[model samples]
Every structure is written in C-alpha cells, then in structure tokens.
Target chain A: MIIAEQKPIQEIKAMIASYQKILVVGCGTCVTVCMAGGEKEVGIIATSLRMALRLDGKKPEITEDCIQRQCEWEFVDALKDRISKVDAILSSACGVGVQALAERFPDKPVYPALNTTFMGMPEKHGLWIETCRGCGSCELGRFGGICPIARCSKGLLNGPCGGSQDGKCEVSKEMDCGWQLIYGRLKTLNQLDQVEEILPPKDWSTDRDKGQRRILREDVYYEQTV
Target chain B: MAEFEPKLIAFCCINCPSSSVTVCESMGMSIPTNVEVVRVPCTGRVDILHLLKAIESGADGVYVAGCSDGNCQFTDGNVKANRRIERVKKLLDEIGVGGQRVEMYRMSAAMGPRFAEVAREMTERVRGLGPSPLRR
Candidate 1:
C-alpha cells in the first residue's frame, strides 16, 4: 500500500492559515490501512486544528469528511457539495488523492496534510518500511523476492558493494544488506549458481526518468456519446 | 477568576476504580464537585481522541484510573492504557497545551483512599496550571 505520515500540525496549520473555512478530507484505502488518514484520523485532525486555531484567536469553520478512495473520480465527486461550502480543502490522503482533488476542482484551493513517503507494507503494529520503488518494472525473480531498488542503500544491481559486513549495510548498522539477504535465500534454495549470471543494466526510461507515467487501456476507457 | 476551580474528567476502569469510587463515597470521602467520573469497561477503551475531546470541551485536566499493572481484569488493559497516556501527553505537548494536564494512575479496588488521593492530586495540579487554553 502507499504509506504516508501526517505532516506536523504546525505545518498543516500554516498551510490553511488564510482560509476561514476548510474541509478536512480523508481517504479510506491506503492511508486508512496505514493509520495515517482514515475516518478516525480525519476527526482527530479536525478537532486538533480547531483547538490550534482557537488558540491563535481565529474562529475558523472546519468540516471533516472521508471518502472510500480519494484517488478515484467517483469517490471524490461525492465531496462536491461539501467542497462547495468550504473555502479550501486540507486533504489527508496520499499524494495521488491530493492531485486528483486538485485536478477535479481546479478553481478551489487544496492542500496536503500528509507526506506520502513510499510504497510499502506495515512491518508491524505502528511500523512501516519501504518495499517497492515502483520503477515500472519487476525483477524480484532475480533477487530472491527482495527488492534491492528499495532496500539497498545504493540500489546496486550487481551488488554486495564491498560495504556489506556481517550481512549489514555499511551505510547504516540497522539496515540489512539486500544482496546478503538474496545470497542467503538463494543458498537455502540451492540456487546460488544464479548469482554468478551477470545481468544487464536496468532500463531507466521505465522509471521516473521519462516524467509522468500513464497507461492507456483501450478496453477500460469509456467514451461519452450523446 | 473566582478561585480558578479546575474541571477534571477521570475515566475509571469498571473492574477496579469503579468499586474504589463506591468505597470512597460510602466512607464519607467526597471527590471534588468539578471532577466528573466516567466508568469504562477497561482503560484500554479510552482512546487519545476521548482525552483530547475532554480538553476541547472545556476540561481543565483529564486522567485515567485503571487497575494496578498486572491486576487488570483483561490482564494488560492498564498496560495498554499507560502507553496511550504517554502518546496523548506527547501530543498535548506538541500542541502547546502542556502535557502535565493529563495523567494515568493505577490502583486496586481495595484502595479507596488512593482513589481520592489521585482525584485531589489531579485537581490541584490542574488548578495550578489554570484553565485549559481551549476552554471557552
């Protein structure tokens, strides 16, 4: 899931300082699972903002609402009435949800209340670690299912990088060397010979190097015909 | 401000603090009139939102009274509540509200005097801090 964390309350307060009436929107999908921006979090943020604003001697009218998935046009459309009532929006969804709202309501101001960090899963209760870089490619088969692009400090392809010591990365003692994990897993599977096969350089164009990425699915595209 | 009577909210665990409250009342020990006692099944049920809402709604201070450590009926309800109290304290500090206003106290059902003591302590501390800034 797309993991994110709420920005500091002070930062969020500053972003909507000028607006007298603001709508706090939450997403129920990814951010909800991550406990960053869900219905419960929407209420918390809204209440906290009210207290903070009151402390500053500003009586702002704040509203809270959560949609199933803020990234979808249909879900965002449900907030049209609420959006019309507020001067601006404080979105607690990931970056994708914020952008979707911005594009949907170009005339209205929208601000993000979270810092979308990475594509990852929860390591444990209240802990999440990056797992995928979304390089627009999948090469997990070559690395024993461990993602070097996201876990390795340098994202080395043909690695171990002379900095792997005792299975730990040289950059940080807490981080495990990604190549070492691959080596151990391969060794357990009796497939250590695969490590000797040198691979070609990754195609950078598939990544963010080409700017904004999109998929044109002709089968899924719906055309309005009058 | 008229002697600054601090309004406090105490979320007490049903299995222990509830009985303690009764024992204290029956023994002619009176809690401060401004302190409101709310009974919950367990202190673990008290979310940070409830604490913040108490303050937002004009509570000068708020605290949770749960069963002493390992004595909780659910085994670790008091332990979980302790961690939540710490989290709410940090949040209060970040919001510039002063974390000292919120606290957690653990006592057994047999300790009626301890219950009254915690109430007086919290009320006095809040009184010293003055009314909550968010109070209208």
Candidate 2:
C-alpha cells in the first residue's frame, strides 16, 4: 500500500493559510491501510485545523470528505460538487491521490497534507515498514522474498556490498543486511546454486522510472462486454 | 462579573451539540469569554490529541457534546468519541488530573436548556475539581 505520514501541523497550516474555506479529503485505500489518510485521520486533521484557525481569530469554514479510493476517477468524481465549494483542498491521500484530485479539479489548488512515504506493509498492527519501491522490475524470485530495492540502504542486486557485517548493514548497525537476509533465505530454500548466476546491472528504465505501466485483461473485458 | 472567570468549554462536531451554534446563545451564554466554540463535522473527528491539548492549554473543563448515541448523524461517530474520551479520561488521570476534568455529552442543537444545563453542570464540576493543575 502507499505509505504516508501527516505533515507537521505548523507546516500544513502555513500551506493553507490564505484559504478560509478548506476541504480535507481523505483516501480510504492505501493511505488508510498505512494509517495516514483514513476517515479517522481526516477528522483529526480537520479538527486540528479548525482549532488552529479559531485561535488565529479567523473563522475557517472547514469541511471533511473521504473517498473510497482517491486514485480512481470514479471515486474522485463523487467529490466534484463538494470540491467546488471549498477555497482549497487538503488531500490526506498519498501523492497519487493528491495529484489525481488536482487533475480532476484543475481550478482548485490541492494540497498534500500527508507525505507519501513508500510502498510498504504493516510490520505489526500499527507499524509499517517499506518493502517495495515500485522500481518497475521485480527480482524477488531471484533473491527470496525480501526486497533489496527497499530494504538495502543501496538498491543492490546480488549484493552484500562488502558493507555487511555481523548480518547487519554497515550503514547502520541496527539494520539487518538485506543481502544477508536474501542469502539466508535462499540457503534455506536449497537454491544456493542460483547465487552462482551474477545479477546483471539493473535497468532502471524498465521499472517505475520507465513511466506508468498498465495491465489489461482482454479475457475479462470480453467476458464482460458479451 | 467575577474577575476570575471559569475556563471556557468547547463543543465540537455534528455529533457534538447537534444543533451547532444556536445552543450557546439560547443557553444565555456568550462564548463564555474563555470558551472557544470549535465546530466539527462529527464527534469521530475529535482527535484524542485535541482533548489533551485543551487540558494542556489550561481549560478548567472541556466538554465534547455530541449527538445522542442512537441519533449520531454519522452513525458510530458518537460511539467512537465516547471511546476516545474514555481513553483521554484515563490519560488525564495518569497525569495526576482527575479524568472527570474532561467530559462528553449527547444533545441536539435545539436543546438550548440542555446546553445551559451542561454548561452549568460542567462549570460546577470543574469548580469542585479546582483549577487545572497546569494553570499558573
């Protein structure tokens, strides 16, 4: 899911300082899973903004709205009329959602209230750790399931980088060496021979940097149309 | 006109003081001098941190008046607020202040008398509890 963190209150306040009528839009998908931009979070931000504005002696006409998936056009379209009513929009969604909202409502300025962190999963119930970089190309099969792209301080392929010590990365003693983890996992799976194959340099273009990629299931589409 | 006015109480959210601003004026209150009226869309929107900050800012008492349990406009917002208030109440106690210092009440905006009752009741309750420990 798209991981995000709420921007500091002071900074967020400054960004929307000029607008008295503000709309806080929350996303209920990735950002929600990461506990950054959910309905509950939206409410918290809205309340904080209102109090801050009240203290400033300016009556801010703040409103709150949350969409199921802000990245999707359909969900954002639902917010069209409401978005038009506000002076500016504060998106609690990840970067994608913020951009999507901006595109849909070209006239209104959309502000990102949350910092889009990375693609990650909940480490525990409330804690999340980065697991993917959306690098476009995935090589998980070659190196167990642990993603070196995100876990390693350097996005390395087939690396212990000589910086690994005591099963930890040299960049930080607290961090487990991604390569070490990959090595251990592969050994356990009896794929040690696979390590003999040197990993070619990563072609950055094929992955996320190549630009947006899409998948279309013609079978499913045909089934639905007929 | 007492020189030392009691702390102002704020009721925020639709689930809170369901009638919005009218309840204050009808209750013969004029923002309680110290009182700040913060309107929110739902009681669920009331962040637990906001409640803590209110107490931190030296509010003698803080009240979150939301829609009655069964009548919450946002369905479970009142319930969520109740749970959050309960947590904040515990936090208040942990900090050596009586958790009762903060409260949540359910009432529609039309209930002006009810609003006054809450105001008087909260004021008296705070008076009995004494000024906030944070007060100088």
Candidate 3:
C-alpha cells in the first residue's frame, strides 16, 4: 500500500486559515490500509482543526467526508455536490489522492494533510517499512524477495560492496545488510548459484523518473460500455 | 421571544436518541428548542470532531447518547464512542474549556423517561457551568 504519515496539527491549522468552510477528505484505499488517511484519521484531523479554530476565536465551518478511493474520477464524483459546499478541501490521501482531488476540484484549493511516505507493507501491527520503489523493472528474482532498490543502502544490484560487517549494513549498525539477507535467503532456497551471474547496469529510463506510465489490457476493456 | 434558549448539539445513536428525545419532551424540556439532533448510524461513527464542531458552532454543550453497552445492535459502537468522548474530554481540558462541556451516556430506546432525566440533568449541569469560553 502507499504509506503516509500525518503532519502535526499546528502546521495543518496554518494552511487552512484563509478558508471558513473546509472539507476534510479522507481516502479509504492505500492510506486507509496503512491506517493514515482512513475514516478514523479523518475524524481526528477534523476534530483537531475545529479545536484549533476555536482557539483562534474564529468560526470555521469544517465538514468531514471519506470516499472509498480518491484517485479515481468515478469515486470522486460521489463528492461533487458535497464538494461544492466547502471553500477548501484538506485531503488525508496520499500524494495521488491529493493531486486527484486537485484535478477534480480545480476551483477549490486542495491541501494535503498526510505526507506520502513509500510503497510498503505492514511490518507488524503499527509498523511499516519501505519495500518497493515501484520501479518499472522487477529484479527480485536475482536477489531473493527483497528489492535492492528500496532495501539496499546504495541500491546495489550486485553483492555487498564490502561494507557489510557481521550481517549488518555499514549505513547503520542496526540495519541488516540487504545483500546478507539476500545471500541467506538464496542459500536457504538453494539458489545461491544464481548470484554468480553479473547483472547489467540498471536502466533508469524504464523507471518512474521518465514520467507517468499506464498499462492497459484489451481483455479488461470493454468494446461497449458494460 | 420565548426567552434566550441555549443552543445544544446532541450526537446520539438511534437507540438512545429515541428514548432521550421522548423523555425531554415529556418533561416539557424538548432539548431547550436550541439543541440540534445529529444521529449517527452508531455511536462508534461519532468522532471527536463532531463534538468539537458542536462547540465551535456556538453549542453550549455537546452530549453523545448511545445504546447501553452490550445493548448496542452494532456491538461496540457505544463503548467506542464513550472512549472517544473521554479522549476528547481530556483534549478539552488541555484547552482550558474543562471537559465538562462534553459528555457520553448510554440508554435503550424504550428508556424515554430516562432520556428526559438525563436531558434535565445535563441542562442544569451546563446551565451551572455557563456558556463555553469560545461562545461569543
């Protein structure tokens, strides 16, 4: 899921001072899965804003709304009428949802309440780690399941660069050496022989830096509107 | 004018609102005619902001009424709402408003008279407490 973390309430209050009628929009997809921009978080942000406004001695009208997904137009359409009532919108979605809301509501300002962090899975109940960079290419087959692009301190595509000490990365004594983890995982799977192969220099063009990319399958598309 | 009535915003659950509203009406209280009823699908749906909005919008006091504990049709709605109420109360205290401006209560739909008693009780309590410092 797209990971996100909420900013402090004081910073958020400063952003919406100009608007009297504000909408606190929460995304129920990636942010919700990560427990960042979910319905519950939306309520917390809304309540915080109201209290801050009361402290300022100004009557700010804030409304709260959450949609299943904020990145898609079809889902955002549900909020069209409601969106018209607010002077501004504060999105609890990741970067995608914030941009989507901005595009959908061009007339009104859309501010982000959460900082989009990374693409990762829950490490445990309240902990999450960066796993993938959403790079166009996949190289996990070469290095166990861990993505060197995200886990390796230097995004090293080959074995450790002699910086590993006792299975710990030189970047931090606490961090496990990504290459060591890869070596162990491969050894356990009897795939250590695969590591001997030299990987060519990574082609950055195919990755996200080039621009936005889209994938379409004919099977998923309908000839006529279904 | 029928005298200056204090505006109250009651965030109540389906189960508790019915009884509370009935009780207030029987006692000729009728929520002080200034109270606005915002019923949620469940008290669990009531977030802390709803209470703050009530206070920010000139409400003298905010009350969250929910189904009595295990009596909630939706299981933990009332309990969760109560927890959130307490959390917000702490926040209110931090702001010098003193959490007394907010409260949570549990009741069944059939407990109409009990609702009125709570309304009178809360009304008197709020009356004694005076207007919210934020209220202009």
lDDT of 2 by residue, A1-226 (tens): 7789988766788899889899999999998888788997897677666655555666688899999999998899999899878999999999999999999899999999999988888878767878888776788888889888899898887677898899999999977888899899999999988777888888888675647877678766655421
Candidate numbers sorted by TM-score from highest down: 1, 2, 3
lDDT string, candidate 1, A10-36, tens digits: 889999989999999999999999999
Query: For model 1, what is the error of residue B49's alpha carbon versus the real structure, in angstroms, after optimal superposition?
Result: 1.2
lDDT of 1 at A98: 99
What is the DockQ (computed on Cα atoms) for candidate 3? 0.19
List candidate 2 stretches off by more than 4 Å: A208-226, B1-136
Per-residue lDDT for A20-54 in model 3, tens only? 99999999899999988999889878877777777
lDDT of 3 by residue, B20-104 (tens): 6766577675455555678788889997767776776678888888998688888898888898899778767765566897899
lDDT of 1 by residue, B1-136 (tens): 3798999999999988989998998899987788899999999899889998998888999999999878988889899899988978877777778799999999989888889999999999998998898874
Off by over 4 Å in 3: A216-226, B1-136
How much lDDT does each candidate structure score? Answer: 0.90, 0.79, 0.83
Better of 1 and 2 by lDDT: 1
lDDT of 1 at A178: 86
- Residue A60 error for model 2, in Å? 0.7
* DockQ per candidate, 2 decimals: 0.65, 0.05, 0.19
